[model samples]
Each structure stands twice: as structure tokens, then as C-alpha cells.
Target: MNIFAKTGGNMTNRRDFLTGSAGLAGILFCGCGLPRAAHAAAAAPHRLPVTVAGKHVKTIDVHSHCLFHEANALMGDEAAKLTPPINGAQQAFMTVEDRARAMDAMAVDMEILSVNPFWYGKERDLAAKIVSINNDKLAALVASKPDRFGAFASLTLQDPALAVTELETAMKKQGLGGAAIGDQVAGSEFSDPKFDPVWAKAEELGAVLFIHPEGVPELNKRWAGNGWLLNTIGNPLATTIALNHLIFQGTLDKFPNLKVLAAHGGGYLASYAPRDDHACFVAPSACDPNIKLKKQPTEYLNQLHFDALVFTPEALRHLVAQVGASQIMLGSDCPYPWELHPVDAIMATDSLSDAQKHAILGGNAAKLFGLKGVG
Candidate 1:
């Protein structure tokens, strides 16, 4: 039966009966009163089905990638310079089918896709076009499989103005979740005044800025040709460098409302926070002497949310102990060969209470992305 069917004027009686059967089916079915699009999203099958504390739970993954081909092509000379010639066909790399399968395997309800920021440091026109194509593709990905995916628009930080325009178009028009920017734009740091306009706009709109590493040029030269040096090590090294720069340089201080999410479990920041704090204390003459501080660098980490991608249960436990579970989100850096199983990893962690487990599994991201029921 199309259970929501109505007759004449007794619609309320019909819905009351339908709810009983729908509940038995374990589906949160909506009536004709709900929007058609909403109903469709609610019915999508790409969701990961989890049994948490006896209740079936679902999740939202905040950090997943898609569409590397466009970025690879746009990278040009930089592409050749890469250690292993960037693979245009990277796994889970942005086809609708691949995404659906991955979501099902990982039990991820939806993945918020971001364009790799590796495409950002090149020619302005090409970067803009690449952004446009990626946005269009992302929007189409969501529209086609609204239940499986959502997007955080990629921006060309090379031109801050263009970034603002793309942000508007992606958020307002396409209903994207947020924007993703590299840790730095080319040689310029994220805290530079040139990016203030972009930051201001993101704050005004309450947009999320997912920060990822693109191997800073100067840092790249230092790690030269060593396998696992640039990516496995240098990437996190770059993340720490950029984060410290943003903090000590007063970027976070100035833009208190700006929401920036860091990848790879916030890199080395999570582990070496005390050093950052100590440096601030002893060498008041070092970085920014005039900048007054109240808390340690780790305190800011609590304010920011991190993905549960640290891999080991012990690491996950340490993260939970350090930042609390509510601030940790589920991120399956899926398609990356080294990525961990998010649900299993969280389950293996003995440090978390049932409530904390609920939050790490899906509750945190649900609240962050405004999903109901779970939150």
C-alpha cells in the first residue's frame, strides 16, 4: 500500500495508521505533507547501517575527496614533479557509483566531498574553470544521489575574490555544505591580509572551511625525492606549520567565528600542543610577543572539531581524552589506501562511554551539519 494515501478529508486518520506500520519497518517514512525531495533523501540507501548500543545508527563523514582528474590536469608541470605521477584514476575518485559503494561499505550515511586543494596554486583562469567544473560536478553528484553525498565547494584561493563568488554560488545555489581551502595559497600564508575578504565572507555566511595540505613549495624542496617524505611526513609537517602560523600570527584571534576544520586528525597539533604553549610562554620574544593568550594551543583544538581518523583505538582514545568526544567527528579519508575503517576504529576504542561513542560515530557531525534525529 502507498500507505500515505488519503481519502476525502480524513487524512489525519490515514497518517496515524501509516506511522504504526512504518515504525515496524524501521524506516522514518514521511507523509505527503513532507517535501518530495526531503522524502527522497530520507529514503536513500547509501547510508551505513550501524548497531550502536542496540540502536541502529547512521553517520556523516566530513572529510572525503572526489574529482581529482580535473585537479591533475590543471596541475600541469607540478603534476610531473609529483613523486609518483599523480593518478588521475585515484580510488573512490568521484564517480557516482564508486561513492555509493564506498558509503555502503564504510556504513557512512553521507560523505561531504571536497576538491583536492592541490589544484589551487596554478594559473588563475584555469583554477577558476577547474573550480567551476568541480562545483558543477559536485552539485550533480549531490542531486543525483542526495542520500549518499553532500559537498563542500572547492575555491581558488589564488584569487580571493573569485573564491568569494564561488562560495556564494556553491552555498546559496547548490546547497553545498561549505568551502575547502589549502593550508596556504602558493607562497602566501592563510593569515595574510589578502585572504581577509574571503574569511570575512565565510564567517558572514557561517560556512565551513575544510583545510587540507597541498605541500607548500618551500617545504617540498626540503623533503626532496624521499619516498613518504612529502606526503606521509611533509603533509602533516605543513599542516602544523600552517596552523601555528594561523594561531601565533593572530589569524584565529582575529577571526574567532571562522570555522576551519583540519585534516589528518589536525596533524601534529593534537600531539605537540604543549610545545606550542611552552614556546608562547618562555620565548615571549619569539613569534608574536604582543599577542596575549589565555589558553594553550590544545585549547583551540577543543574549539575545533577533528575527524576520528587517527587509525588506532589508542590514538582515538587519546583524542577523546584530550578534546572530548563531542568535538570529534567521523572521517574516512576514503579511497586513500592508508585510511582506516571509521566505524570499526571507533568501536575498538575502549576509552569512550556509550554516550561518547554515539557522538563520535555520527552525533557530532550530525549536529555540525544540522542533521536531526541523530543530534
Candidate 2:
């Protein structure tokens, strides 16, 4: 059942749920923020300039990641789960200089750091403690190199009430630009009404909600052996599912202004968004009659934001076509090399104009994060 049914409430006024125009499932190529990300790069021994049409632009990597030693310590044995079989652990715990060097190499001028969640299963007290440690360390890191970093605060989502407070503290006090989250919270999807207060507060504070994925463990057997299918396939799949739930559940309707930035190029949804509009019409039995989306399914794309980590020029071009240049920003998934050349992808999108390229590189993110005076 979609969340609307579970909540047992009728849809709001048509004007409330409906916003934005419909998007075609397929479209033309095109293009598409931030700082604590300037001076440190100028001091680097070797640097890469991310420019569009020979003009420099700030390249903000919104999907970048990090993890903390003290916070992970709280997880004890469970901390091991945060480290994938890959050799990314070193980068996750990278020293400030090392992270700066990595960003320079990736041609990313600024990185908005986030910890892939390990606190979702912890109890309220433990989760709050872990989140507090993570937020404090993240604040310190940004302070240590204010020109090279920004962060999305770690939140204790298992306890929604605490998450609201943590978000407020992080944004209002710690100076975090946003909150990063996994696709699901313990056993609940974000569409569950239990998360309304967090969404409400995020909307009120204008916080950016960056949704990363933790893979689909329920399908572990299907992903067994070779190629890390769980991450390669499951991660995007999980994001796709979470986004759809939010779209159809009227969560987006209820909190229309919440700034949501979906990682991994907003997963598979960016590729097939317009396709979702046809489902309820085609399968009357599968979809709940009582639950209906306010806007056309594809229209929700306008309210959402995405990263440019789809890994190919045409894919990047296609995502821009699907979601619009205003909604995208650079992302390297750095610290691991899913996107070995983020800047090059946009530079190579032959269809993108310089303006589109500049906006995607950093302008959009800078505006969203409330960063001013950035290059």
C-alpha cells in the first residue's frame, strides 16, 4: 500500500498536491555549487580547473563521503559493515590533507561530506550520541579547512523526534548545509508518517536532505558473487523505490518545499521518471484507489534535486533532459572512484551550453546551500 492509505486520510486540496508541469520520459541532451572550497585548491601543488567554455566554475561534489573513527567506535562490531569489501576504508578516514588532495585530483573544488549511515539500527540514546559525535567532528573538519569543505549533518533517524532536533542543531549551530540519510530508516521507509516532523522541520529550516542508499540486503542472495551487485544494482534500486514512495505517498505533497538531493544521479528514476505517470492508469488493481498522486508522477521531478554521477556524457545529458539543469550538481562519489572524472563528463556533454554547464558545476548547489562569494 502507498503511504496515503496507511495514513488513512483523504488527499489535500488539489492545489496543494499539484505543482510543476509534466516531463517527457525521454528528451534532448543538455547540461546542467558551493564552498568551503576555494583557497585550499589555490595552495595545492597540482590542481585541476573545472571550467565551462574556458571560464572557471566551482565544482561541488554533493555525493562525496566520509566516516568518523569515534562515531564508528560506538557501533563496535557493527562498524565493520560500513567498510565495503573494497579498499575505501582509508579514504573514509582520510586526513584533511588527503581528502583535499583527492578532491583536487577529481577536479572537484568543494566536497560536501556525509557518512553513509551506520546508526539506523542503534537505540535512541546510542543513535543520538553517534550523531552528535559525527556532527561535532564534521563541524571541526569544516572549520579546519573552511575553504575546502562543507557537510551534511549526520542524523539519528531511528528516532524521528531526535532527528528534528539534531537537524536544527546542525543547521542552526554547527553550520552544516544539509542532512544526509540512507534510503530507509531501520524498518521504515521515509514515506512513513513517523517522519513527518523531521520533514516539517527540514522544510522550515530550508535544509537540504541528501538521500544516499545502503543497498538492499533483503536481496543478498540474488546479488551473491562477483561485481558487488548489491551496490551496483541494489543501491540505485533502493533509491528508486524510496523516491517513488515519497512521490506517491503525498509526503512531497505535504511538504512541498523540502529540498531533497538524491544521490547516485537520483538512481534509476531520473532515467524513467515519466514512465511512472502511466502506472496507476494501467494497473487499477495494483495501485490503491484511495491513494493518488497530486501532480503527474513526472511532475515531481521538478521538486527533486540530483547528482551528476551517472558516469557517461550521454547519461548526464539524459538526466539533465529529464530533471532540468537547475536541479543537478556535480558528484564524484569520491573516496571511491565510481566517477573517476566528474568534471570531464559535463565538459563532454556536447549538447550542454556553457550556462547549463556552469549551473550544473556549482551555481545551483551554491544557491541551494546558501553559499555566497564562492568562485
Candidate 3:
């Protein structure tokens, strides 16, 4: 039977659900007669219930981002002194109410907020200050809407010692769920030995390290032309490189308990992981026996989490086949418009069972972030 047909004739395809057609407003506003915005305000930080196929599911978006206005101002001034000033008003920061309404439109129940890396190149003291400010703001925001938002703390990985201290403070004092990090720190890849302390700390704390892309600066010239390749290709390419380093260098082996969540569906690595296995078995010379992993490279994929932002049913299905449903979580890359219809994307997949869809939508993330009332 078609997945849409199983949904009791309420939703059909991703496009329709996103466009707010085909009884979408009714589905979104089922119990409440109020407008979506007003309903969201009444719910405040908690996700309003959404029913799919007569089953209520709480949608958690693990890949959404936010930019704290105060942190941006401080960093913006410092950035100006270091580089050529590009003049323009900053993109208006979305307020909490604005974000809540947007979430309602997307049918998302909760968001695990993270900020894109901006202080990776700052001096140690300056970077520490920025990390403090970002984490504090994120903590307060999540606290204000406990049901609606959770956050990954920011870290200054360029100085791993400071990163360790900051991570401790964020997790212990601020009660942040995890830390958000870029693919690389300055010129240092995450696989560098200098980061072992940070990794060890995360493993101990059981924190989820969200690896968002900072863009591959070396490829700027190639991505400069039309088509936005810098983001289209560069972003995933950066994540792919970072994960590869961690895999091949045995970072996952060293810290097996490290809970890492890769954005953009684990980039290109998850889909192409079999190649690593083949290279290790078929081409021994190409593989380093000295690295010494306890299991096959692909097996480590089960140990990690990925956001379902692949944008197509086929791609999402392939990722599940590669990683498994439990490892895949809903991630819209929210507020960026990269995925205007995330819930519909998963709901429309003919290949997934209702159980699988439920897990990807919110169950897995609820477990990962320790969210309540999602079961």
C-alpha cells in the first residue's frame, strides 16, 4: 500500500504538505481552532502534537541552527579588524516567537539548536569569550522554552585545552546537551591527536558532538562561480573529509563511546562506506593495518547519528539501508530553507515502515538528547 494511502487520506506528498495544501492546516491545527502562530505561542516551547496516519508523532529537528545576536555583534567587530570589511546589514536574527511559528509551519515539535562556526580563527582569549557568550545565550534560550529547544554548546577547538574546560562548563554548569563543532579547526583536522582530550571528555560526559560544516576554505576558488557550489558541494565535502579522517585515523576506535552526529546525512561517507571496507580487505597496502580498528569501518556507522536532509526519498532510503533507521534522525536544516518540507519528505517515503518513520522523525533524537514526553 502507498505510504500516503496509509496516512488515512490526510497527507499525500512532501510538496503538498509543505505548501499547506491537502488538509494540511487541519492536520496542523486539529485540536486547536486558533491560527498556527497563536497556537504555537500558547504551546510556548513545547511542540504541538501532530498526527500522521492517525498516529501522533512528535517531530524533533536535530539539524536546525540559530545565531545569537549579541555573540554575532562581538564576533562581527573582531572579524572586521582581521579581514576586509564587507558592509551590509546583518540578516535579521529570528526571534524565539518567529522560530516557533516557523516550526509550526514545518510541523516540527522540537529543535536541537546549533550555531555555525564563526570564532574558529580568533585568538584564545577572544575565542573563549565568544564560546562563553554563545553557550550562555543558548542555555538561556533553551531554558526559556524547555520543551521547544535544546542546544549543542560552542567550543574553541583551535585550543583544545580551552575546549576541554569550556565543554565541562557547558555540560556541567549550563546543562547543555552537547557541543557544536566545525569540520576543522583552523588548519587542524578533528583527527589530530591534540583533540584527544576533547574527545575523551565528550565520551565521558556522553555528549553529542554535532559536526556542522565550516566550508572547505581551500576550495573557495573552485566554488566561487555560479551555482553556490561553496555550500552545495563544499559543505558536504568538508563533512566527508572530517568523518573520513576520524574513521581512517581510528578516532572512533579510540573513543568508541563518543556520540557524534553528522549533519547532511553523514555527508557522502555513509552512502559510499562500502568502498572503505573493500579498500581495507581487497587492497591491504592501501589500508593501514597499524591503525587497528576492532571492527569493520562500516560498523562504526551504527555508532553515529545522521540527520535526514538528503531531500529525496531514494536518497533517504539508501542512507537507511547503509546506516539503519535508528541512526537516522529528522533534520531540516531549519530556518535556512534548505529543507522547506522535512516532515513530508520522511512521510512520503514508500520504502519506510511507520515504525521507521517514527524513529527518524523524533524517537531517535529524543533518546539522543534525553527529551521527555516524545515516546
Candidate 4:
């Protein structure tokens, strides 16, 4: 009854039936005869069906989140903790078990988990408790399913000394992938002299710091009542602020070994940096005294890592063209509602070669996460 049998086989009704359903037809046709790269053309509207770089290509999602039920139980209702009760919207999508299933459904080999910065805020004491609880939960989750999950620990940047201690435990003791840090630690930017010690510890441990946007505590009110309009502009601006401070103040040059990663496709760093240099043309002093670099601000941006969450074929191509494929990796931002289909987006792009696609999908992340056997 197989429709794909030799040409001499009878054209049975079963052959006609299989060809009608798009999903089944795609699987049968691709599985039987088409070239690997052509598989994406048959994808369903919401699904990601692209050519995997290699056989059984194990995709590693470098960006994802988890919430600790225990942490919420500890804080009283009045506290502004960014856990389960964060907002009706966040609560709707954030579930560890559900996230795991989604990863499995998407054929993700592993997910590098993190806690959002909203949960930690700026309270040192509360941040400490949140860190312990979150780290405990992450460790247990990864340990429970070692093959399917890995995590990056969140540190209380409010206390650098405590952050150092936490990094050792998270990266060395618990076998986490690395650490997650925000754009600013309680309004103090990365270039502030106070952060040198934290960066030093990260450099020594070779930790990967996933930088997310947590806008200044004072600025949240500036965007009033439009259903998280601030999130769109605010998040990207926070990242931009962090990158500018890091570059203009010489944080990147000083802490060359820090494996810092920027979220939301590296914010505005890739697109707007040329104008930055043009503005600096009026004053030579616009460049920081700390940095002795001959290169422009965009050069440092290229040196950092970016996740492929830009959400467009054009944006993806520009990202790759700006930063080499080696610096880009897959990031679905899963369960975020705004999540884009990374595999399909990558496949849709005509600018990248097969080798570049491989790096963006799996190869770069495999190396970053120390994923074995893929090397």
C-alpha cells in the first residue's frame, strides 16, 4: 500500500489518501526521496522544519527560563518578587514542566535555563534568598534530567562578594553551564568601578554571563499604561545602555576574557553603532580614556555573542553579516508568546551557506555549552 514503492507498483487508493494530508505527505515525500535541504518547504505554518546540519543534529537552546515554586512560597504577598505571580501574562506561560515538554516536542537536545531579572530586582537580602532558591531549583531540575536540561545560575549583583561565592557553587559545584547577569546591577552599569571584582571572578572561572535587560528602577514609570509598551522599547534600550557603557568605558577591553552574551539580538548595537562613531567625530574626547582602541564601538559588539532571536530573515542575515556565524547561536525565547521559529527563519535566509547554517543552529552552541560528540 506504500505510495512511494517502485514505479511498476499499482496506484492504489492508499497512495491517493496519503498525498492529501500535508503533514503526512511531507514526511513521506521527504523521507522517501527529496534532498535534505528541500525539507523546509513542506513545513506546517507554526512548526520549524528545516534541514538539520548533520545527522540527528542535537539543537541546544541557549536561552530559556524557569520559576521556582518554593521561592514564591517564601516571599509574602506584599513583596515585589518577579516569580510566578509576576503579571497575568508571565504567569500564563512560565512553567518548568511545560517548558521541558516544549523542548522535547521541538527536538531540542538541551535547554540552558535562566531566571528573569524581574525576580531579583535590587534588594540584596531578598536577592540573596532568591538566588539560593532559584539555584537550588535549577540544580535539581538539571540533575533530575541531566541529558535534557542544563542551566545558568542567577547571581545577586547587589552583592559582588556573594555573587563570587554563588558563581563558584553554580558553575563548579552544581555543574551549571554558566551564570546569568542583567544589564545593570541596581542602577550601577557594568563599567562602574564597583563591578571589576565581579568581572574578575567570572573571567577566572570562564563563566558565560547571559545579559538580559532590567531597566533602571526609576524609569519603569516613564512608560505609562499601554500594556507593556515599555517592554518593547525599554528592554532594547537597557541592552543598548549596557553595551555602550561597556565599550565607551573600557569594560570589554579590561575584562577581555569575560564570555558576555547580549539578548534580543544584541539590542541596537549592530544597527546604530555607525552613527555613534559619527557623533563622536565632533569631539575626540567622546572616546573613553580607559579604552586605548583603534577600532570603532561596533568591533567590540562583534566580539560578543548574540542569540538568533531577531525574528526575521533580513535581520538574521544582517546579524550574521555583522557578527561572524561563529558568534551567533540559536535562541527561541520559548513560551514568551513573541517567540519566533528559529529553524524556519534560518532556512528562509538565502545569505548563509550550509556551514554558516550549521554553526547558527547547533555548532556554535555545542561549543559554547561544551556539548560533546558534536565536535
- Least accurate stretch of 10 residues (summed lDDT) in model 3? 24-33
Error of 2 at 59 (Å): 1.3
lDDT of 3 by residue, 261-339 (tens): 9999988998788888777677889877789888788888889899999988999999999999999999977555566
Per-candidate Cα lDDT values, in order, are 0.66, 0.76, 0.75, 0.66
Give candidate 2 misplaced runs (Cα > 4 Å). Answer: 1-47, 88-92
Q: Model 3: residues >4 Å from true position, as ranges?
A: 1-48, 77-91, 281-286
For TM-score, candidate 2 versus 4, the one ahead is 2
The 10-residue segment of model 4 with minimum total lDDT is 25-34
After the best TM-score superposition of candidate 4, give how far the Cα of residue 86 lies from its true spot, in angstroms.
10
Indicate whether candidate 1 or candidate 3 has the larger lDDT.
3
Between candidates 2 and 3, the one scoring higher on lDDT is 2
What is the C-alpha lDDT profile of model 2 across 1-375, one tens digit per residue? 011111111221222112311110111110111222222223323247766667888888888877665567688887676667654343344345556666777687888888888878778899887787677656655654557788899899988888998898888776788899999998699999999999999999999999999888899999988888999999999999999999988899999999999998988998878789888888878887777678898999988999988877788889989989999998877666566567777777888889998998888999899888863
Clash-forming residue pairs, model 2 = 32-360, 33-362, 33-366, 36-147, 36-148, 37-147
Q: What are the per-residue Cα lDDT tens digits for candidate 1 across 1-375? A: 222221121111223333343211111110011112221222322335777787766677787775434334556766544323333322212334444655666667778887666655578998886776666656655654556677788898899998998887777776677897777887889889899888888877778888777765676676777575777787777777788877777777777778777787777787867777778568766766677655567677776767887878888888777777888888876555344356666776787887887787778877776655654
Give, for candidate 1, the lowest lDDT window spanning 10 residues.
Answer: 26-35
TM-score of every prediction relative to native: 0.80, 0.85, 0.83, 0.80
Misplaced by over 4 Å in model 1 are 1-47, 68-94, 221-227
